[model samples]
Target chain A: MSAPVIFDPMTLPSDDNVNAYTFCVELKGGEWFLQKGKMIAYYGRIEFNGIGHGRFERLLRTSFHSPLHASDWVVAQGSGKMLLADRAFDVNSYDLEDGNLTIRSGNLLAYQPTLALKQSIVPGFLTLIGTGKFVAASNGPVVFMEPPIRVDPQALVGWADCPSPCHHYDHGYMTGVLGGLRSLTGLGGTSGEEHQFEFVGAGTVLLQSTEMLMAEQATGAVPHEPGVPGGGAGVPGSGHAGQGAAPRLPGQLGDLQRRFGL
Target chain B: MLAVDMSGDSVKAKNGSMVAYDGQMAFKKMSGGGEGLRGMVTRRLTGEQMTVMEVRGQGTCYFADRASEINLVSLHGDKLYVEASNLLCTDAGLRTGTTFTGLRGGATGNGLFTTTVEGMGQAAIMSDGPAVILRVTPQYPLSVDPGAYIAHQGNLQQHFQAGVTFRTLIGEGGGEAFQIRFEGDGLVYVQPSERNTIGGDV
Candidate 1:
């Protein structure tokens, strides 16, 4: 048997991955905004405080605008090298130079405080803007694809450069009444690939090799206002009680339209 | 997979963990990890129970469990502390026993006792993924999430640290509220994945 490699603070890489599933971030009295519990271990004197801490009020106001997710995040400050990992998933770091990228909330691990995090207009997603490096985890290695491409919803990690991402259904599968019925009820053995998230214009799309998705912690609901996607109507306590919490599929055109063959 | 070669020497391994063997082998169930009657009673009381079998006279014996990654550690008299479930196999020269871990084990949801392997030999531990071994020194103390901690060795002082505050009661607690701080000189083994512990959600 061979001895395992032992990493010390001096030997640990700075702001890089220790292995496929582990990333090490070095802090020289600097600060990092990390999702709660993503920190597996750390060396040196690092302190973790929730976003609600009084000392972090200014920081949260400037970079962390998603109050709905305040409880799920923490700020790690002080000098030390910390390690981050997620459910044994592959973790990679991306540097955004004054660019914007929207990612599935559950995949994000840690980011430099120089970046501003906002709740994306797209529900269940968060957008990071400005310059800095951020670590994200994927079920498998991430694949970068250009725009004008369609991707399976579960396989998509995020998109960069503000690509126009919208739902697309295969015309060959949803062309007629029979096709609509087949898709709506799966009565004709509908293939699960009938719908996808289509990206057009410019920018790159990130997709995990596997379709397995990370379980997302609800980032709370969007504001109950008209003209907002996932707003009003079916939201709980909006007088639409009993409608259930199951989110509407992207390509879904409502039960009424599908039933009437619209 | 862990391959153990023996030329009449014996090794203790988790029961039923041997997957393949080449050459003559004798497997004897070591009641209470071969620690004798006292060790058996101690294991039963501590609840850190392990069913180990001694494999002797083997050419090359392979051991695996659930396809988990196996990490090999060579010891030279220093004791190795690990979770019972993570220990795959240990050389016959090593001695295994149970020790109270206080609140650290409670925070990890692994009971209040932990398994310790002492003496000079090689031991194999299992993890959900490959484990990262970090060194803790007097100048650089280490803090670890209880859920991801697997094992540690050398002279180290571990203290269960809780970050709970008034905000925690108000539902704004950091998700990493429970951690174990290790000071002194030692190597801490942390898995790439975390076990579901009680402090995970908060």
Candidate 2:
């Protein structure tokens, strides 16, 4: 067998991937926001501080806007090259130039402090705006597709510059009584692809090669105020009105009861 | 997966790890890792147990365990310190023993002792993903997350570094509050993925 390549601090790649599952970020008196417990190893002198540290109050005000996610993020400072990875998943870095991208919170590994990170209005997702590089991990290699596409929810990693991202259910398949019965009970074979996240307008949609999602990170609880989606009050006059009642079973018609005007 | 080619010789491997063989081979269970009574008692006492099997044959044998990625480490007299679970296979000529690792092993949740491999031979280790081999020099020491550390070789001194402070008590601790600092001349193997170590959360 050929000798395995040994990496020294000088040979380690800067702001690039050492392998498919690992990314090396070089910090030279700069800072990077990293998710908790994602760092594997590092070289040189580097210090990791929790986001709530007093010294980062000013930095947090400008680059971090998600108060709920404060506990999940930390800041790495000093001069060194650090490796980032998550559960052996395929990790890749994306460069954003004055652009905005919304991604699942758990998929994000680390990002340059130049980009502002805020909790997405979509609940479990987070949004990054401005310019800089961010690293994300997916179950498989990410595939980029154009908008006007409907993607499996589990397969979707995120979307960039997309104007509208709405849920799309096969209206024709779930209209009548028979259709509703099939979807509600999985009787007569449900296609399992009845619902998808539809993206329109112009932008790039990122999808993993597989449909398995990474474990979701807790984004903390949003305020229980009105006019806020997932704000604990539930959607007003929507199918979620009964969500507070003991949780619904998978094949139950809990939400579909609203469709029947019951 | 690791394929070992032998010509009427023998190689010691993790027990029950052999998946396939292309030629004739005889497998024998090595009680106490074939290290005799003293090694067995030491391993049992240290909690660094290794159930090894010796495979002797004139053909090629394949070994695998739990679908983990296998990495090859060549030893030319220096000692290799690895977790018991990460060791896959080693040449029959090498001597395997147990050593006390102190706080570093406890922090990584691998007990307070580790397995050591010595002699001139090639050994195969396993990791959750491909392991990155890093060379540590005296000038530039390396600090690795305890959960990601798999193994190390050469003359290196490791210290369990904890950055816990008043902030850590308030739940605002740096996620990487605990690390294993390796200094000296050696090669450290770190997996791309981290195991759930006892000190992972802080």
Per-candidate TM equals 0.93, 0.96
Tens digits of per-residue lDDT, candidate 1, B47-79, equal 899999999994999999999999999999999
Best by DockQ: 2
Candidate 1 Cα deviation (angstroms), residue B94: 1.6
lDDT of 2 by residue, A194-244 (tens): 889999998999999998889999988778776566676566777555556
**lDDT on C-alpha atoms for all candidate structures:** 0.90, 0.92
The CA lDDT at A220 in model 1 is: 95
Candidate 2 docking category?
Answer: high
DockQ for every model, please.
Answer: 0.76, 0.89
Whole-model alpha-carbon lDDT for candidate 1 = 0.90
Scored by TM against the true chain B, the candidates give: 0.98, 0.99
* Most accurate candidate by lDDT: 2
